[model samples]
Target: MRTVAYYKGCLASLSAKELDISTQALAPKVGLELIELEAVTCCGAGDIHEAEPDYYLHLNARILAYAEETGADTLMTVCNVCTLNLRQANHALQGDPALLERVNRNLTKVGVPAYSGGVEVMHFLWLVAAGEGYELLKGAAHRGLKGLKIAPFYGCQILRPSKLLGFEDPDRPSSLERIIEACGGEAIDYPAKIKCCGFPIIQAREETALAELIQPIEQAKEAGADAMVTPCPLCHLSLDAWQSKLKAQTGKDFQLPILHLSQLVGVAAGLADSELKFKRHVVSVAPVTDKLAV
Candidate 1:
């Protein structure tokens, strides 16, 4: 069995437990041995870097250290922000001796081993969609999303700063689209395919944030997307959790059900709606579930 350390970031641990639930429940089916990192903490998600750069560096380094302790070759994250935070920290620490020393010093303060960049940080999407190969994912597909139109939401983390992230062509990402197609679904193409979900600036720029959230959703609805699928829990929340609020603000109903990539993959893998906790979503996933029932 191929082993990897699972890093369920802060949002998934609290706000979006369903992503964690579906990922754990679906990993085995996709031929991965997921080892959960219990000692792991928040990655700080780029926010702490602004004020306390050391905190961001140290927090992610500590998480990487824990993953190393698990003896796993890779640290797997389901959240885009977590992937960005951890990967950026890993890239920085490995290349900069001074930064690594500072971060390791902080980690040593808490009795954790200093990070030596031993483990690879990656998104779960890379493992299944790219690493394990689409054929493995397709072979695991007991049920097909034959008629489902899934709009792939990449968010920003995995795509931007393309040199460091290295997941896909930051200019145009087809990984998610390919995965959706491999699952037997139509991947809808839209203008906002690579746009930010505005979760990052909701506090500082609420109005602009709402507008950013509205763009892709409306585009997806216009493109005949049955649901929006994303890998980021924060993006999921920005799209699903804030739908009603956006509807009220814009006087337009965008009741599109936002799905975590795992949930969508689980559905394609023939898992039941109950198994993936569809009801946990604020937006009713009835459209997608009803299609699955057929």
Candidate 2:
């Protein structure tokens, strides 16, 4: 089993507990032994980055320092925002020796280990799509997705600003589709697959967020997607939990189930629905689960 430092981020650790639970359960099945980072703080989720750039760097640098303490060469994240923040911090620190030295000095003052720019930050989806994790997934998916048509939702963070999180082509990504196929499901290709789910701007612009959220599901539903899967819990929350508001706004009921990338893999690996916490979702995953072969 490949051991790496796991960073579940704020959402997975809190509001999106199911993502954390499912990811922890699924990791071992696919030959990954996750050494979760201890006492890690929020990655600022882009808010701090915009308001206080130095503070954002320190926060992410602290998280990376925790990963370094774990003695793992890689730091794994499940959230798109967290992945971006950490990767951006890593890039900035590694590219500038002076900045890394200053950050290390700050960490030292706090009795934390100085970061040596050793850990490579990676998103879980990228791990599965690009390495031996893919082969392990294929081997472990005994039950398989069979007839399910899963649409891949690669929300903005994981794909955009390609210089930092450039695991795949931001313009034309195929990692999610590759993962869906590895689990024996048909990967539905849709234009909105690469579009934003609008969770970030929801608080300030409800109308705009709803408009952005509706397009992708509408396109996915039209394309005959049984369910849509995303690596980001924030996207899952906006796409799944906000459906009621969306129905209220547009008068169209979109019951399309949104599964976290981990849940999708857990199902394909023959994990029980309860184990994956399907009941927690606002949209019934039954529509997708019912199509699976027993």
TM-score winner among the candidates?
2
* Candidate 1, superposed: residue stretches over 4 Å from native: none
lDDT of 2 at 112: 82
| lDDT minimum window of 10 residues, candidate 1 | 129-138
Instruction: Supply the global lDDT for candidate 1.
Output: 0.88
User: At residue 174, what lDDT does model 1 achieve?
Assistant: 94
Candidate 2: give its CA RMSD in angstroms.
1.0
* Per-residue lDDT of candidate 1, residues 1-294 (tens digit): 579999999987998988988998888887889999988788888888777987787888899999988889899999999998889889998899998897788789889987888899989888888766466788887688977999999998888888778877887889999889888899999989789989999879988999899989999999999999998999999899888889889789888999999999999898765669888899999999898883
Query: Against the true structure, what is each candidate's TM-score?
Result: 0.96, 0.98
Over 4 Å off, model 2: none
Error of 1 at 87 (Å): 0.8
lDDT of each: 0.88, 0.91
